[model samples]
Target chain A: MTQKPSRTQALYAWLDERLGLTTINKLVLDRKVPKVNWWYTLGSATLFLFILQVVTGIFLTVYYVPTPDHAYDSVNYIMQGVRFGWLVRGIHHWGASFMVLFVFLHMLRVFYMGAYKYPRELTWMIGVLLFVLTLGMGFTGYLLPWNQRAYWATTVGTQIAGTPPIIGPWITRILRGGEEISALTLSRFFALHIWMIPGLMALLIAVHLYLVIRIGISNPPSKDE
Target chain B: MSSHNPHDLSRRDFFKIVSSFVGSLMGLILGLPLISYFVSPALDEQGGEKWIPAGPLDNYPVGEPTLFTFTLTKQHGWEKTAQSYGVYIIRHSDTEVTVFSNVCTHLACRVRWHDDVSEFICPCHDAHFAEDGTVISGPAPRPLDKYEYKIEDGTLYLHLVEG
Candidate 1:
């Protein structure tokens, strides 16, 4: 008589049949990255920073208040009152800057390598979109503190957005949620910073990663193809 | 793929229906609280005016404006915050009192009472406000904001928004 498969083997076979888990592992995890130096890691680093930002931002939201009246005080309370709140906020604050910096550096590396040329145009375009989204996140998050610097800086920033040829005024009004910055502006910025931009970024990042994997990382510049 | 027997097909269909029902029930069990947590802030009621007692009228000396500080509790969504509010109380007479917000009109800096200069000086932009809350000099675009105040039974109450 034929022997029955072991319990572990049966379970694995069952999962593999439905999910093709092993095939996914072979295609994704076992796929080889180019044997370039440390420069290839910046994209992954930027992704890591994005995750860190999301986690810390979620923690901050527990105590943060997005309102003109209490935004500043709530930030102060987070930085001072909650346990290890300073560490979380500090990491989030610095992580945002690092994310922007790393994304720029990664783009620079890709551009310098001419990876944007030929078959990788779509990848490069998605990357550029991600860069703009990162900037949007920074701009939106800057106003959450609602202090003098945050207030005036946002005012000037929105005014600059109001300087474009035809769409300037509309952009400013949409960003500010009205003619001037008020509680509505704070609410808009908060929504964009915490959810909308991040959600779009996540989707774009997934697509960018899929494209990169499908196209493969471009080879380093060399004499031969 | 292989063809299945009718008896086996019916059994599989029953399992599929049962699994989907269980999956939907599980999703409902997990999703309701998360949805509520996300929407709680938008549904919060955080508006209304509350008159806060700054201090007694007798505490202020005549002519010389004294700063009265009071704690204003603000509620935003689920968070309750207490911010210190300060106003310059100028007692002109026994019944007449003028209260000016310490916030500078130029850039919202806290203006302090300078006894030597005899005018409120904004260290931020060097703006000056006279004892009567008018802009005396500097980049201030308007006079200091006068908060609505009322004196009742020797106690001075300021009409402030409590979240």
Candidate 2:
């Protein structure tokens, strides 16, 4: 005689019927691949760090003010006033550094393995974009505090961006919103950091993940291939 | 080979419990403080009131209501802003002085001293006030609000009540 289904089993069945959970489980989770070493873990690690950054970032925005007048003080308040705010901001801060590091290391791994060639070329291109996006995240996030370091660092950074001949000054003007890094520049940087860069990164990441899963991870190459 | 312990909990059932428990626990831990962080600003109150110096008491001529404009450094959220304010100082004599808030009692419009009308005129609703700050006419609910003042070493200090 067949036993009755348990509550958990019934609930899962109810969800699986409508959501196609079994198809997802089979395709995304249970699919088999070639045996890989520790190096394959770096990509996943970078993705994990990005998720951590996103979580902490959403929390930080609740208290963070973007204007020049309040940016530094708001960050200072996050450090001292709000409960567990330090923890949230700390993770977002260090997670950004670690995410950038992991993205680079992951790229290095892919490069060393010759996995960027063949059917995975598109994936490699997207991965490169993700790498640049990760750096962009770091660059924009660094200037948000509006402290002395942020001010001068962005000043020099935009100046450097402007050094490449005809387009240089135009690029600096676009970034700084004027001849100097003023309140408008601060607000513009704030907008880019919180919305534009990350928004694009998130879209790229979804496509990147889809490409990785669909194309399947590349096999560990031998000298012959 | 097919003979198994029927009374034992299945591994799948055990994992379901563990996953649900761990996931809910993590959500609760992170979710509660996030709510507090966002709502903290809404619930905050400014610390207290203190005396803000308007100007020297001797500077205003007797029997004339002169405008005294000053700025207060206000701490709001993470911002410290200098908010400008205007008041009218009517010095009756050396020992007695009355300070009226320039803000109208009706809709908080700035009332100006009109020499032709001989009354403080609120441009917004045309409310008028007499020399002593009593409501002369129009939609003002009451007399103009007065600032409590204390003379210290011949200086006029306005008692500022914090919100």
Candidate 3:
């Protein structure tokens, strides 16, 4: 006698009939990766750091106040009052630096391996944009603590933005929302760090992954293609 | 089949058009509110800049810049917190008062008053400011900021704006 289909199989088949999820799974899972060394893992490590940032960042926002008035005290409360808040925040902080580092290392590996050339040009371009987004995330996150260093560093950073040329003052004004850094600047940075850059990063990351899967990971440079 | 009505819409095309319209309308409905919410913080005026009571005017003596520590209750948007502020209140006379911020002009490091050395020293970079808050010998591009102050009813109040 024939047995009934398992629940998992039934649900998957029902969805797969409409979504072609099985084809997707086969496309993603059945692919062959290059026989590269462990250096190939840097991209994955960077992705892991991004996930860590997202998780820890969500935890942090539960208590963190983006306003300058309460930002420092809220951070202090997280450190002193909340259980393991320090650990979560510490990981988030260190994870930001780690993400930047890992992305840089991944790009360097890709560049040295000549992965940016040929059909992978778009991937390299996306990688560069992602790298920039990663750095933007770091720069914006640095000010969330609302400490003295953050305040002054942001001041200097904005001033640097104001040094370009005809658009320098405009750049600074747009960033700071005025001639100087104020609560608006903090809010702007908070929004950019938590939403804007991360949103763009997520979309680009999807595209990057799609391109990677489409083109396949390039082999380490050799005389033969 | 060849005698179909000209204005007749196919089911699939009708669904596609209706769904597209509904999707765009939903996106607009959701996106406008979110954009407004995101931009509202910037639009709301930061209402913390005001004159805060520092202390009694008699607490400061003549010729010596006394450090007056005060707590400012600040409200920025929905968040409210008390932040500690310090300023050196120097009384040249009964009417002349010069209040210098303890924050170093270079990098905003707290400057310490050293009576023994007769100079305000920023420990971060070993920068020194004179008793008059001049950049005596240091990397400080400018003198310590002179905070605005007002005396009312023998009470000292600082025009606290930016840190």
TM-score, chain B only, every model?
0.68, 0.73, 0.68
Q: For model 2, how does the per-residue alpha-carbon lDDT over B11-83 read when each residue is reduced to its tens digit? A: 8667789979997897788777778777776666654787888667889999988999888787766767898
Name the candidate, 2 or 3, with the larger lDDT value: 2
Off by over 4 Å in 2: B1-32, B42-75, B80-163
The stretch of ten residues in a row with the least summed lDDT in candidate 2 chain A is A80-89
Task: Using DockQ as the measure, name the better of candidate 2 and candidate 3.
Answer: 2
Residue-level lDDT for A8 in candidate 2: 100
Please give the RMSD of candidate 2 to the true structure.
6.4
Off by over 4 Å in 3: A1-7, B1-163
Residue pairs in collision within model 3: none
- How much does each candidate deviate at the interface, measured as C-alpha RMSD after superposition? 7.5, 1.7, 10.6
Q: What CAPRI class is candidate 2?
A: acceptable
Candidate 3 to truth, TM: 0.57
Stretch of 10 with least lDDT, candidate 1 chain B: B29-38
lDDT for model 3, please: 0.85
Residue A206 miss distance in model 2 (angstroms): 0.9
Q: What are the per-residue Cα lDDT tens digits for candidate 2 across A109-178? A: 9999999998999999999988888887887888898999998999989999999999999999998999
- Candidate 1 Cα misplacement greater than 4 A, ranges: A1-14, B1-163
